[model samples]
Every structure is written in C-alpha cells, then in structure tokens.
Target: MPLSAARTALGSATAVALLLALVTAWASGTARRLKSGVLPIPAITFPPGPAAATSSATDFQEPYFPFLEGEVATASVSVGDTSHGFVVNAAQVTQDARLGILPTQLARGLDYGTEALVAMLEHAAAQLYGATKTRLWLGNVGQRGGGDIDFSVSHNSGRDADIAFCYTNWKGEPVDPPSLVPLNGQGQAPKHGLRLDAGRTWIVVKALLVYPRAQVQYLFIAGGLKTQLLAHARDQGESPALIQRAAATLRTPVGSASHNDHMHLRIHCGERDVLGGCTHTGAVHPWSKLYEGAKRLRTASVAATLSHGEAEQRRRALQRLVLLGGSEHRRPMAACLDDPASGVRTAAARAIAVLGGRDDIKPLSARFENEREVEVKIAIIQAIGTLGGAGAGRFLAEAVGQPDREADRLLRALDTVTILRGPALLSVLPDTAAALSRAIRTARLLDAAAGAEPHALDRLGALLADRLLDSDPIDPSRLVQLAAIEAASDSRRLELVPALVGLLQDRDPTVRAQVGRALRMITNFSYGVSWASASPGTRTKGLQRWRAAWRRSRGAPRDAWLITGFKAGGYQVPRLGQKQTWELVRAIAGADHFSVNAQAVLVRLLDHRPPSAQWSKNEACQYWLRWIRARRQRYDLDKPPVETSNACYRPAP
Candidate 1:
C-alpha cells in the first residue's frame, strides 16, 4: 500500500481501539460508579523518608537537599515529554461532593494526574467552594498510562490539567456552567449572555499559587480574561507577592488556541521525577528555584554515582545524566565508553549524543573503532551524526565505505550520512551512493526471507534521496530512482517536474505509479488511470496527459500549480495579490503531500519560525491560519511586517 493509505489505516485502527476502550469502560460501569460516588476518595501518599534529624542535618549542610526530599514526598513520577510522555504510577483524581469538584462526562475515567497536581486541584477547588459554594468543572487530565488524549496536545503527561473558568450572569450571581464557554474580549460569553466572574477566578488562581505541593508552570488562558482577573485581584487588595506570581503564571500561548474557554494548567517536573527521565520545557520561573537548584545538585550526584556504582546502577545514572541535559556531564559519560558492561557503554554513548559538544566527538569515534559490541557501535555512529559538523560528516562518510561493515551497520551509517549532508558527504557522493544501494539490496533480501514489509529500508532510501537530490549528479540506480521519486512527491519539489515527467515511461510499473503520484501532487491534475490495474493503452494515455499538463504548467509561475484547481481563476498569472497568494498558501497548507513545504514557505514569508514540530499538522495549520487572518492588514505577500513578537519571531541580539 501507498504511504498515504497506510497512515489512514493506522488512524482508523487507533479510532477503533479508542472506541473499544470506551465500550469496555462503559460495560464495566466505571463511569456510572464515578458518578454515583461509590469509588472511595483517593488520597495522596508518599514513600517513607529518612528521619527528621537526618533530613534536618542534610538541609543544614546543603540548602538544596530539602527540595528533592519535598518533591519525593509530594510529586509522582511523570516520565518523558508532556506531549509524548507517560506517568509512572499515576494518581487518579476522583470526584468529591464536599469540595464541589467533579470531572465532566468526557473526563470521567480520564482524570489521572501526578499526586501533586491532584492535590493542588483539590486544594484550590475546596478553598473556592468553602468561600463561594461554586463547583469547579474539570476536563481531561490524562489517560491511565498518560499517552495521547483526545482534543489536547500537552495533557499526555500528568502535568497538564484543564479547568473551566468561573462564570457569572449579568446580575453578578455565580453560574455553574455545564461545559466550557469561550469568552470574548469584554469577559462576556456573548452568545450565552454570561460574563466572567473575575473575582472568583482570581480566588482559584490565588489558591493554586499558595498550594505548596507543585509549582504551576503555566496557567494558559485568553488575554482578555487574564486582564480582567488581574484587575479584579488588585481591586480586592490581594498581597503584592501573590499578585506578582499570578501575573507571571497566567499566559496566552502563541501558535495555539486562544484558550478563552478554560485554563490549561501545566506543572513543572519534580526534582525526583527528573531523575526518572521527566523533562520540563519552556521557562523556569523564579519561584521554581528550589527545584532548579536541586536538579543541578542531583546532576553532580548522579555523575559521582556513574563512576563507582554497579553496572545497572551506572546505566541508570548515565540515563539520568542524559535526561538532565548538561554538557558538563559529557566527559564523565564519555569515560564510560570504555566500561566493561556493554549496556553501560551503550547508555554512555547515547547520553553523549544528546548532551555532548563537538569536542566529545573524538572520544565517540575512538570508542567506535575499538568497540566489539554491535549495539555499542551503532550507538556511537548515531552520536556522531547527532553532533554533526564537517568532522562528524566525514567520519560517517568513511564508515559508510567500510567494506567489512555488516548490512545493519552500513544502513545505520547511511542513515547518519543523510542527516549530516554537507560538502563532506557530497565530496564522496559516488561511494556513499553505492553504499546506500548495497544496503537497500541486502535489507530487501533479509526482509524477503522474513516475509516482512520493506518499510524502514524504503523510508531510509527516500530520506537519502531528498538529501542527495541537489548534489553532484550520478547515474541513478533503480532503488535510488524510486526513492528520488518518492521524496519529490512528499516534499513537493517542483524543480523535479521535468525529470519526473521523463520517468513516466520507465519500464517498472512501480516507478510509473510513483511518478504519476508525484505529478498529481505537483500539478493537482489527474488523468484517472488506475496504475495498478489499467490496460497498457490506458496507462500510456494517462502518462501522455500528465506530460501535457507539465508542459502547460511551465507557462505559469513556479508556485501557481498550488492554486490551479481553485475557482479563483489566476492559474496562468505571473503574480498574485497578497490576499490571493495567502489564500492559496492556506489551502495548500492543509493538503496531504505539500503541507510540509507549505509550512516552510509560510515560515520564510512571515519571517517567523514555524510552530513546534511536535504539534499535529492540523494544529500547526490552524495556528498559521489564525495568525495570518488576524494580521492580514499588517503584512504584504512579498514583505514581512516590521513588528513581530520576540517569542514567535527572530531572536533578539
């Protein structure tokens, strides 16, 4: 099957899996049990700690020592990135009638979080209800294992939770919202005839700030609501320190939803969790100094352990250093490349890849030469590639040409070369090309014996093709040609149009089909030939028609093909107005094949970095569309605006 069809099938399978999970939950009466309060309220628990005297003595000796202890007692382990991580031993937030907090129907079985996060939410909600008798409506926290959750990007880890904002009627009476309501600039849900209850919202924010268990990283909300809440906090004579923390914590995230409906709360990774591979992205607020200081101390301690511990202990320590991400640990980790245990050596090499500098490359390359373990050798090659420069690229080029290297090693080296593309690799293109051809052939024979799909090998070939397309031309091998065709289609490389047209008459049916797909992606035109089952005559006519379309497209501007089928009727024009150009770009940004190129072009045109690559394509597209529509008056198609946010635009000097 084609790549596009494979993605669709995978999406369908995921949907079916989710549906089955929901059905099982319903059949087991999990939702009904939660609604009826039969499940007991869950309490936060901590592992046993050292005696008070020991803790106090440690604190007196080192001021930062207490922070990790505090974290251990309060925070649960959140392992990995928030968008792609999972929680280890997750804590589930249960409904509490006395506290007037309940998960919405959609969040019933989904309200799992870290112990600190659950405690923080309960504390804030209980404080609010004790004063105002208003209930806090909770949205999705995360799933049981904390992987992907529906309708959210950051809640995959237990650190993120969504809560509905306090709302009120025109008479200033508190309103219990059935669900989230998106508010306008004036703090009013215009369609719903409700206004934001800034005073009550400020109370929740204040309670969250005062909660000592976890430090809040971000309280993402709409800017308009943030203004009203801050103003209300001042009017209520809240402490200056409290107001300052709230001011710094509340944010309006760029390149994402305005977050006018509810606040998305993310907590910092606890110091103890950091040792377990938990990572925190974004800023480290002043209030989080305790945790930050503890992390620095822990890094040194872990490095010490790496030198003296048993093999398993050293491996864990090495892994922790990688997660901590300090360049200073690179030398200590590199020293372990000579460790007796292969696992320790593997972890050390991989750690250096992530945290090492250019100077660390020599140690990795030296280790690769003497390493007898295949796994350790592969890890070193990967590390060299990741720390790419002229030196690293040259090392990879040499590794690729080694005749005694196994097929797996050759393929790994080729993959590295693809990422390290520059003059170093280009200078040896023929050798690198021949190595790639050999690797693919060997991989195919191996896969044929195992009766497995050649997906990984094919993907590697395509990536190499994309990297080598602009280099010195070489006589194309069969697999190289197919890979080039696939890369051109995926990247929307319009400059390859003439070459792709020439491949229409290639002897291989697979080549012809791929060429047809590439032409369709480029021109947005189809001759309706089923390349798989069509007769020879029908296939010839389809190829001929595609060639004709390619000829006609030559008269138009290079990018006109993007807007070819639209009703706007500027197909043959040389230059489109700003509105028409952006409109076409927006349409293509949502296309399957050209979306990546669309993102790159849009980034250049706007003179801003694209949104996080971690975001779903749909999420990124939506952000760009909203950004352009809001600032359409400020920018022209050919020139970027003078003013741009430092957060989203080019960095300041």
Candidate 2:
C-alpha cells in the first residue's frame, strides 16, 4: 500500500481504538487503585537497608498515581476512623498485586483490603477447583515487562482490574488471574467471557470480609457477600465482623475487561455489601441449600457420591480439594497422574504441578518420557515444570528429543532453565551452573563433556556457539534462543564473538540480525565494568562490531546496543498501520545497543491508525480484547511525525 494510504488506515484505527477505550474504560473507573507504568516497569530497585521496607501496606494513607513521565507523586491516606494516615507513593503501585484499572469508591482506603483478596486470587489455580488445570495471568499486570492501561478514575476511587489466568507450564511458572468466565470452560483463553456466577463471586467477597486493617472490606460488591462474610465473622474477631458488615452496602455497575481491566471493587468504609446489614446471619445458613430431591442427594457422608444437580456442588468440592492441594485426597496431586481417564489424568497433572513436592519429580518424569500420548506427555511436562526444580529441567531435556516434538513443548522445556531460578531448576545447565551465575560460568566452558552435572542448556549452547562453529540456517527460534543465552547467564560470548561477527554477513537476515543483537549484549556487559579503561584494541573491536551491526541493520537499531538491550518480542507483534510495518521498523530501529527504538517507536505509532476496540462486556473477553486493542494502538507501526526534507511525514525515524 502507498505510504499516504497507510497513514489514512492507521488514523481510522486510532480513532476507533481511542473512542472504544474511553467508552469501555469504565470498570476501571470503579475497580481500585493501580501503580502500572509507574517509574519504568523495570526490575525492583533495592534500597540500601532492608529493601527500604517498601512502605508497608498499612503505610498507604492515600492512593498512588505515578506520573506518566515525571516522578510519582504521593498523598496521605486518612480514613475518617483511623487517626493515623499512611503515605502512598504513586510510584510504588507498580509492585502492588492489584494490576487492573480501578474505579472510584465512596469511602477510601478500603480498596487496599480488596487488593489483598486480588493477590490471593492471583495465586489461585485449577487445583482450587480440584482440576489439575494450569491458569495464565489474565492481564498485563502480571506481565514480565511494563505496560500502560487506560485506567478511568471516577471521583477519587479506582476499582477496575482486568485479570486473566496463567497456566503453569512444564517450567512451573507462576499463574495469576483466574477467570470468572472461561471460553465455555475450555482451554482457549482468548475465547473466554466475563459472566461470573453469583456463588463464585460470593467466595471472593467472603474472603475479603475475613481481613480488617483492609479499609476496602466495606465495599459493596455482591448481594450475597454480606451474609456470607457475616457468617464467617461468627468465629472470627470483632474487627473482621465490622469489616464484613461494612462490605454489605456497596452496589454498582461493572463492565468486562475490554475497556476497564480489573474486577472493580469500590470501597465504602462503613457501607455493607447489602442494602442493610444482614441480621439473619448465623454460621452461613445451610438452609439456603435446598436439595432438588432426596434420590438425587447422596448420603450425608464423604462416602456418598456428590450430586451434580446442585450446579456448583461439584465446583465447591473441587475448591475444597484445591484448597487442600490434593491433601484432602492424600499424596497431594499424585493420585490423579495415574487416573484411567485422560482428562482426569490431565487435571491431576496440573494440580500436582502446583501443590506437590519433589517426590512428584520421578512420577512426572516417568509420564513424560514413557507416556505415548502427546497430550498426556505435555500434561506431565507441565506438571513437572509447575512442581519446578532440577527434576523438571531434566525431564524437559529428556522430552526435547521426542519425534516431531511440539514447539510449545520445546519452549516449555527451555523455560524450565530460567524458572524459579532454584537449584532444582538450574541443574539442567552444563558444568553444574546451579543458578544464573553458575549457568553463565558453566555455559562458557565450551566443552561437551557430559559429566559433573552438564545438562541440555550446555548441549544446545555447545552445539551453536562452540560445536556448530559455522553459521548455517539453524531453526530461527533456536538461533533466537541462542542469541538470548547471553541474557540468561552473565558470561560473555567472546568465544562466539567471531562466529557472531561472521553471521552479520550470513544470507539469512533473521539469523544475522539476532546474532548481531546477541553479540552487542556481550560487548555491553563486558564494557560495563571498565569500558573507559579497556585496552585500545578491545575498545576498537567493540566499537567496530557495533558500527558494523548498525550499518547492516535493515531498520531501527536494537536497545541491546543501548542501556537495556533487546529482549526480543515474546509473542507475535501485531501488524500496525495499513501495510503493517512493525517487522520492518523493528529490524531498523532495534539495530543498536541503545534504546534508539524508543526515539522512533512511538513516532511510528503516532503515524498509524489504531485498532478496533476489543472491549467486551463479558469479563474474560473484555480483558484480552482491551489488552490486544490498546497494545496494538500504542505500538502502531506507522511512521511517527518528524521533521524531514520538506513537509512532516510518518515513516522510518
């Protein structure tokens, strides 16, 4: 498409996306506070003493709102009853667990209590439902890198949160954001919806009522919340009871994750979840549970089969098992791995992955190596990964060579190397690199000796860096992974320096480019300690390599050549603008060791059209939709506006 036509298309998309974002960005208006995009979404900066204590939850007096570009400003949170107020740094919200766009509430400070519940829910797994299911984080809040959200704040409260589930892979990565609406309760996470059953909603509410000091305990959420929480308050202290009573009065509107990103919880300090404090609460009246028929009901014992007619009867039972982590059934999740039914066995594998101990390693390994069925093997790998450790890594290594192995499986296997960063996980590296540091040193050995504790990482690295010594058309992902090895460990790729330098001239641009980026990182890490003091030859070589890569780059230079360096895009970068030029732009802008892309990345977006709104009313659909839409617009590939030879134009910076 012509450049002018591309600009027109991008403008249309931008208009649609922005309008939808403004319209659907409502739930976030009611959800709660957030600290996203606050102070650059980078690694946690450690304070000199005791991590600077990171301002305790109680220290939050006012809500935090980090400046988009400037320093995060703070306020004092002073709830009427609490004489002492805490200071809330707007910048600190990034670390807080509640990642959705929040809405406003009548009473303030109570939202923090709601955030506590979000944190726990963020940790919930299918095990909580007695299913060996793995969940994925629903929204960008739980994403590794930083992101922007269209958080709409009404009044002073922020209650929107867009959360999703995370499925624990064979790497045993953490899962967050359970879904209220799944895609017909299937595995296609993107197809999910947002309709939350009332009972499940009640579980969320009751959980919050149990904690006090959480000013948000009073927010009116579900109609049934007050009654449920009041019953829980029976055996608990008065403070909890007061909080539950306070939660009974809040009632408001909510939208799906589309525009707004979180489960908006508005806190009214003294407001009850119900219209009036439910006086009819005593140990949560079981009388409300009316069985449809005696024949349908099982005996009042664990021996009796559960009745499927009661709707959530099965779900609640599963929740019980999940809470117990297979303890309720014995041996954590071990029993399910061997279940006769494939689905049952699959679920068991997932649950056990999250709850079981190292004892599961051998069994999960056996299933992974020996299981004939691809699905079962995949499940087993995920279970081992979820369980996490050296065992998982070993299992992944063993599975890597299976015929026609799925790429997903390979990635899972590779992911195990970095997960948890525990000794059990690092054991997969060659030369016994127990953790990141050891992985670095061991990977440098350049020996294929299969001893002392060498693992697949060593094998893969040795094959590419030392063994495959020549540049060839290797699998792109493998090459990309090799390029990434430098980041995985701290060791420099000097041995492969010559190899990487040669790749710049290789026919395969993808291979050549990735090699160049990796090489840049190696040079940067080496210079950090003594760049200014390096020998003339070493400095010259580094400069010469950098200049060569920059000159050869088809598009923008990479950040790996700069301060942070390119980590590479994890998922398919959406096509932006009419011609969808991101791949082109990334190739050019990401050519250097600096954030040279930053200077031009946004400019590219400013030049393009935005995406159609993905905001849906259903919870799950809304969340994913908004994320896709917003991210698309923000990263639009249209050339950004800049001064040129003549008039302004959007294209290569």
Candidate 3:
C-alpha cells in the first residue's frame, strides 16, 4: 500500500482498538455498579443524591467536575464587548433547516460559532435515522462579538453552544417543518406535535464523541432522560466502548434547572486562540494538547513572518498575537509599530496595548506624538492606558488637560485614566483627592468607570465623601461617592456609610436613589418603600431608620450577609473547627462567590461525586446543616466528640 493508504489504515485500526478498550472498561464499571446496587437512573429527580429514590439499575457513569471559572472576569475580543472569545461562523440562515434563531440573538450577531460538530451531527442524524426524519434545532451560541448574553452566566465565552434535541413523530418520522418540541423520557411530548427520537439522538451524542476535531467539555442533559438515552444505546447494540465514551460526556447539571428537553454542548476553547484572561474550568481532556500544539505551530509561523512577511501576512500575524497575549511576543509586535501598512500598524498597536505593561509606556507615549495616523494614535493611547502606571497616567493627564486637544480624544483619555486608576492623576496633579475630583467632574465618567476595580471604589468613596463635606452648596462629585458606595466592599462600607447617610437629604433625586440602593444592599433595611421609586418622604424615613440602626449597633460596621446566620452573627464562628466548617460550607454552597476549594469540599462530602443525579443546593445544604447540627448536639457538655460523623453523612429524605 502507498504511504497515504497505510496511514489511513493505521488510523482506522487505532480508532477500532480504542473503541474496544473503552467498551471493556465501561462494561467492567457497569458490573461493579450493578453488584453494588447503584441505579442506572437516580430515584430523586429534583436534586441529585446517592442511591436515588427509585431506580436501582446500573450503567457506566463518568466522574463529574464543574467548568473552570473566568466567566465574568475575562475581556471580550472586541472593545466594550462582554463575551470573552470568538467563533468562526458555519452555516448560513436556511429557512428549511429545523433551526430556530432568537431575534435578539440575530440582531446582536451572537448566533454564530464553529459549526463543524453541529454540521456533522446533523448529517449523522439524517444518515442513521433516514433522510428528513429529524431536525437539530439550535439555540444561542455566544453573542456577536462574543460577550455576555443577557440570559446566561457562562455563555459570555464562545466555547458554549446550546442545541435543542432532535425531535421526531411517533413513527420516527421528522416533525413536518421541524421545530423544538421538548419531550419526556417516554419519548412523549407534553403537547402532541412531536416525540423524542432516541436512536437519532444517540447518533448525535456518539458523533460528538467520535468527531476527531471536536472536544466536547460538557453535554448538559436532565438525569432521568440521560438514563433513557444510555438504555437506548445499550439496547441498540452500541459497542460498549463507544457507549462508555458517550456516557462520560452526558451529565445532569447542578445549580440550574434540569435540562430536560435540550442539550447544552460546551466545546473546549480552540487550541490556537490566545486567551489572555480567559480560563477553562472543565477537566482538560488529553486530546486538547494536540489542538493546542497545532495552533501554537500555526501562530508561530505567522509571528515569525511579522518582520519579513507580506503586508496581509503580517497583519494576520499581528491580529493572532493580540489574542495570543504574552510579554515574550511584545518585541516582534513593537516592530510592527513601523509597518508600512496602516492597518498592520493599528493591529500591532492594539496587540501591544494589551500585552505591554509599565516598561512600554515611554515608547508608546513618544509614538503618540509623531504618529500621524488617527487610528494608530488612538491605538497608542489605548496601549498606554492599558500599560497604566505613573508615566502613562501623566501622559493621559497632560493629553486631557491640553488646551488644543480634541473634545473626543480628551474625553477618551479621561475615561482611560479613570479605569487605569494609578497615581497617574496624582503624579501630574496635586493630590489623590484632586485627581478624583477632576475625573468625577467629567459627568457620567464616574459611573461608567466604577466597579472595575474594587480598590478604586474605596478611594473614590473616601476622597469624594470628604470633598462633598467641603463644598457648601452641593458638590457635583457627590454622585461619584454614591456610585462608589454601591460597588464598595464591606470593609469600605464600614468606613463610608456613616458619612453617606447624610446624602439622603440631598436635593438630587439620582443621588438619593443611588445612595438608597447602596444602603439596602449593605444592610437588609428598606424603609417601607423601594428606593427606585422612593418619594422624598420615603427617603427621609429610610434615612432616619438607617441612622437608628447605626446608633443601635453602637457605630460598628454592619456585617456581611454571608455571616448573618452564624452563631455569633459574624463570619468568625466560635467553637473548635466550627469556623472553618462554616467557611467550608459557605464555599461549597457558593452562596455568593465561586471557590475551587469549596467545590472540592462539596465533592468530597458528597462522596467523591460531582453535583448530579438529583443533587440540588437545597438538598446539599439541608444535608450539611443536619449533619452539622447533629454533630454539634451530639455532645452534651459531658459527652465526648461524635466520632460517627463522617463527611458523607446524610439526613433521611
């Protein structure tokens, strides 16, 4: 055989051997689960727990872990955009494809991504279940410009894609003019237009697993329905290996409603895309390294040609380097500052803006003066803003204060400096208070730039609150204090609240409303009216009530909500190991924040399992609370410690 043919033959054999090994592994797991009396389907459908309420059937179940954090922290590929990544668009809008697109998603340019896996799955359904027998409907992928979508917490990134399950008629014929019709495990729809196509659905799941280039991170499905799919696969004589691999990807997600009718497929990030701030929370599959290696090689090839490549090649390389952010790549990117093509130069500036830090500020500022291209100049300013330190701040302050500066560029400089929040203003101007007052006077700049930095809020509140007291008539910067108070940490609030209560008497309705909201968030007190709609009378009463509470607490800072229910009414619980236990529980429950440590504790407490199979936060909380209370009470003052209390202890349902 020729070399190409021999390579293909080897690939095929490897795939087959891998499949068989997977089947044997899966079969062995199934036998263990069966002997142990673990069920194929969880009994309690509401929240996953061990030994579910009804079913005792056994099948291969994969270990579970949540996706990696970075959902909100990462910047979108586009400036002022929210989504963190980008997807290459696949299919055009086709009227005949049973796909439904949300109008809002379409309007925003979010309804696109790498559609290869989707295209393959669609093809597999048609081939396996007969032509025109099923239609794969799609929901939102990332929004256009890949930022935060209004309805999802994690879809701010491009890796996640929501596709509705395949629907068919009772006779296994495609629903005429295919549309999504959610069905239960009996393959029966709540309303009678269509039924679930189990075989076709299995084919879709199998295709995702076997698709050479596709690395599906998680396939969110309802637990009861997943049980049906696995059974269907087994009954259809699917090779044990293929079924096992497919089973590994399917899961019933916790912290959300059961994904009964649809599947949320989150693929891993592209190996080549350089995500500076983006993070992957899911388990890293071994195959992902292959994609990453290939992508790195491609990017390296492009970066290598930056000095000597064609204009288009250099521009492409510049864009790639921007996504693949690194200090090491900055030198080549800096060289692009002098590129003959204006577009390439602009791209180089933007890339450098993100990658360059304090050291690059001086060169960037010098370039800003001589660079004649308006776009490239703007890019340089942006780079300087991102490279923020005293030097960058001084440059920005000078630019904004320049008498000849254009209004728009000056405003842009003002906003950038506010975001950078270094000694920039102070280094050039008189003091910290003076710098903050200048930024706050810019009108709406304070609100626009607030909350990006937690510490910024602290400085704004402290400086501006004092400034407010000094001004006789009212200070315009008072709004800055109000906005800052809303975003301030509990520690900042401790220092600012006593002073802020006086603002309730301010004549400005906006200031009063903002202050009210901040007070409400910081404390549970709301004086018989919503601040958003509060009247002058309401504000007076609310302020009076807050004052009384402040005095009652003897001027101590109000407590954070996370500690409200603890024994001493603070986060610091008194008892042997109890403080740590409360923190662990809070972390596990993720009441207000995400913590890997908390998740790990929850996993261990739940017996080395990820939250699935009828596991709800309420159930987990109740179980832990009961265990804690029981252990706490286990010892009377005379009794010894409760040795019987294990981490996996559960209360009776």
Candidate 4:
C-alpha cells in the first residue's frame, strides 16, 4: 500500500474510535438537549456563615444533589440585537453541516457562578439602568462540568459552559450520535471557540462582568487568568500601568495553538448532577493571576478582593473606578450611554444622575450625540433632559423636534423630563399632543411629561375640558388617563385654577361630577409641595411637631379618608385632597419649616400609587418605598447585617 493511503486509513480509524467512545459513554442518556438554567450555591460550613454576611458563597450544588423533578432544560443565544428564548424540547441540533454551538462550560455543572453572572448582570443593569439586559437564547447553554476534552458534552454540573469559536467539522449530523473531528493527536480538540467580531465580544464580556452575580472564567490564559486579572486589576485591585501592560500583552498575537475567540463561562446550577467522572472539589479556579498580570502590566496591582458594603458604597466605589471622574475608565460611567452589557450602562447613567454634578454634562451630551444602544441612549437623554438647565432645554427641544422624536433616547428624555411647564416642554408639546390624540396610554411617559410641565393641563387643557363636557361621560379607562394627568399637575401657586376650573364645566357628566375629586388633586399638590420640597434636616422638626400633636393623630395617615364625602376613583390616595390632613399633620408634627411637612406627606405615601392615577402617597406606599431605599442603603454598606427579618431583602454580595 502507498504511504499516503495508509496514513489516511489510520487517521480515519482513530477518528472512528474516539466517536464510538463518546457514544458508548452516554448511549442511554436523556435524549433532550439542556439549555438555560440556574443553580444556587449550597450553604457552606464556614465560621458559622459567610465570612462577611454578604460574602458570596464560592461553591454551588454538589453533583450528588438532585435537580427539581421534570424541570425542562432550555437555552437561547443572542444573534445581534435580539434575545431569542428557547425551551429544551425536541430541538433539531444540526450535528454537522456547520453547527455553531456555545454549550455549557461548567466543569462540575452549572452552579451559582453561571446563574449568578446572568442574574448579576441583569440586576446591575436593572439597578443601574432599570431594565434587564440579559439576552434570551434558544435555551441557556450549559452542562455539568468544565475542563473536559470533548467539546460538545456539557459535563460539568456547576458553573461551566463551552463555546465553539469556529466550525471546523461536524459530528452527530449524519445520524443521532454526532462526532467532532480531532483538531490534533493526543486527543487535543481542535480550536472551535466562537467566531465573533472583537470589540463586540468585549461588550458582552463587560455586560456579564458588571452583573453582581457573575464570575468569569478564561480558559487559555498563559498564566491561567493572568490576562483576565490584569484587565480588571487597576479597577479590581491592580494599578493602572500594570493593567495597561497586560492589555498590551493580550493584544499581542497569542499562538494559534490556543483558543482565544470564544470564552468558557461557568454558572450556578440549581442542583448538582454527578453523571460523568466530573468533579470540582478543590478544583475551583479564580482569575486572580490573570487580573494580577494585567495590573502588573498597568502598574496598578494591589492586594485585595472586592469588599462589600452597602449599595451606595459599591456604587460610589464603582463610580470612582468606572463611572466617576476618578478612575482611568472615566468613560465607564458613559459606556451605558451606548453599552452592550445590557443594563450596566443604564445603571451607570442613573447612578451618575444621582451622584449629581455639573462635571457630567459634556460627556452626557457627547453620549446623546453619539450613543447607539437604544435604551442606554434614552437613559442618557433622560438623565440630561432636565439636568441641563436652559441650555440643555433648548438643545433637548431642538433634538426632540426631529423626526422619530419618540426614538429610544427621545422617549427616555420624555420620561425623565422635569420642566414640564416651561419652554422645553412647549417645544415637545406637539409630540406630546400627538401622543395623547392617539390615546397612547403609556402611563410612565405621560406621567413624566405631566410632571415635567405643570402647565401640562394648559397644553392638554382642551382634552380635559372636552372630557368634562362629554354628556355620555368618559369611560373608566379615560378616567384613569385623567387621574394620571391630574397627578402630574404641579398646581403651583395660582395658574392651576384655570385648568381645573375649565374641567369643572366639562360636558361629560363623569368629568363634571368628578370635579370634586379632581379638585382634591390641587390639594394633593399642596401635600406634595409641603412634603416634596422639604429638607432632610427638617425631618427632626417634623418629628418634634408630630410628638406634640394629639396622640390620636398617630393613626391619622391610615384613617384620614374618613373625611372624604363623595365618589372615589377606586385608587386610594392617602390624602389626595384632604388639605387639612396634610397641613395639620405638618403643623402637629412640628416638622422643620422646610422638611417636616414633606416627611409627613411621605409617611402618607406608604404604598406605590396606582399605575395610572399617579396618586400614590399613602402609608403602604411610603413603607415599601422606604424599605427599598433602605435596602439600597444596606447594599451600600458591604452587605450589612440584615436583622433576620430583612434577610430576604439583602442584595447579593
């Protein structure tokens, strides 16, 4: 036989042998494909509990642990802008003919790490930006373990996922049992990581990293996670120069023998599955070294892991390092203006706004002019909408006047606008009018617009006036709209009278009759002013006054509605129109001239207002709001000790 022919025969036999082994290994396994799923970290035997109550548990479900019975496994992928969700049912996974699969990479199995990353990112985005940034895939790509030679079998049970960077050959396609061609001898799988454009991949990576739950794994760094560590070193712990140096090294062409394109991510698994000979006992790997290398490269390496505090602390620290002006990544705060990490950018924008400053204007405007992430851009627009004063207002008006004024940024700008009665509002009134004429019931947008311009009643005056005039009466749905409009009314000084006065003569019997209730909105405004404009310092004064009030008034917020005399909007607003309830509360509470009234009113707003009515001030509303805000404060304090009762409310470390 010719030498070439003999060599081909041997190679074919070898490939066949390996394929047969994979088949034999799982010939009786579940027929369905597994995708997205979450795995929680098991309680560890520590010095009682977490090193710090907030410290995240490093381990997850043990393989011996079982998953909930009959729970379906599914996954999906992000193919550009859309997130496609899929359930693990009869999926026609193409074995050959170029199946690009990014399967689970967890070594032990999908565990808290994997699940946490996704959730953390989502949480961060929502916390930072108020929306979820996670992409939905056919199902979540996953498996039981990591460090496995066969690329397709998702063996690791916890925190591991695999990706095919490139498609070289196919396996299970010609039939049920698929096979991957060996990249080389010695059972070294061929480099088949995902193939993606570079900068975009970084965006995805950033999004995952920002999630509080995520912990990323880099498969082929020369020094394990040296490269990874180096990148975040300056921000995470290393110095700037060291990080830059590491960045330079990563930019260097890493020898092709290693996979560089696609990443191997490990996630949390709901329970452990010990099917394969996979185990992560004492095998946990951290990206510590890689981060260090990058820090050394950037000359910014230091000692430490992220320390927990309250949300505010983390926010401020991240801001200083990522969002604020202090860190080298000054643009970090600005990235969400057009970021790919779903919600990171949004959260960044919101945080920047709350940490209010004149310094952010230029960067914010730049993002407005150049941003592309629809939601991120909108956030930027919204944050800067009312923040820019007259100059920002003019620019916003002009920018908003263009076609497609309701684009993401435009809509977001409309959402957070504060100067509703002024020139900026007047400029956008045309669009607002058009929105209302079409009966577009976007409660948030409408409420924001109304609140932004107190004279919303003036611009929308005709609509209210007409509704009042309708003899047939506006339906319940329309009443909801009216309520939202009324809620937005600032009722400043005297101008509010005409708008309400006009509604009094409305033709609609409902509008005419509801005038009394609507009149209460004016009083609601008084409550808002007395409460909304107060200072934190004035709280003490209010408390003092409250202490001096008749003891019976202690329960006033809960029962004040006894004073109302007629038809109700079904939506309960604690003191919607009880002017005396508001005024007397402020007086009795002896609140500071500037703030006690405000605190009194806030106490009234216990629960969130009804979706449409915008009249949310009440005890339940106030309590819940205070609770969330306090929890946020707890998050800022390195995950403070929750007095057991609040355990459920504590955020992830």
Highest TM-score: give the candidate number. Answer: 1
Instruction: Determine which window of 10 residues in candidate 2 has minimal summed lDDT.
Output: 39-48
Off by over 4 Å in 3: 1-83, 93-112, 131-161, 166-197, 269-281, 309-313, 338-345, 369-375, 404-653
What TM-score would candidate 1 get against the native?
0.56
| C-alpha RMSD between model 1 and the true structure | 16.1
TM-score of each: 0.56, 0.26, 0.46, 0.22
Q: Mind sharing the TM-score for model 2? A: 0.26
Steric clash count of candidate 4: 168
Q: Each candidate: how many clashes?
A: 0, 106, 21, 168
- lDDT against the true structure, per candidate, is 0.56, 0.30, 0.44, 0.29
Q: Residue 481 error for model 3, in Å?
A: 25
Model 4 lDDT per residue over 376-445, tens place: 4434544453244544444444333232232322233221112222232122121122222211111112
RMSD in Å for all candidates: 16.1, 25.5, 21.0, 26.1
Error of 2 at 193 (Å): 42
Q: Ranking by TM-score, best first?
A: 1, 3, 2, 4
Model 1: how far is 590 from its true place, Å? Answer: 11
lDDT of 3 by residue, 1-653 (tens): 23233222221112112212222223233211111101101000001111111112231111111111222222222111122222222223332444455444444444534444345445544454454444555666654223234455445335666666766666768553234346676657857667766766777777677766557767899877788889999998989987776677788886465677678877665442223223345556554433455545655655686875467556655654544434477888887787888667766765665456678777776766766554455456545544555575466444422222332332332222222233321121212232222222111111111111111222223333232222322232332233233332212233334555666666655455555544544443445455545777876787787788677763543433223323322223233243355444543343212222333333444443422111233335444544455555542222212321332233322
- Tens-digit lDDT track of model 1 for 158-217: 799888889998888998876788899998987887899998888888888888878898
Runs in model 4 deviating more than 4 A are 1-331, 335-347, 386-392, 399-616, 620-653
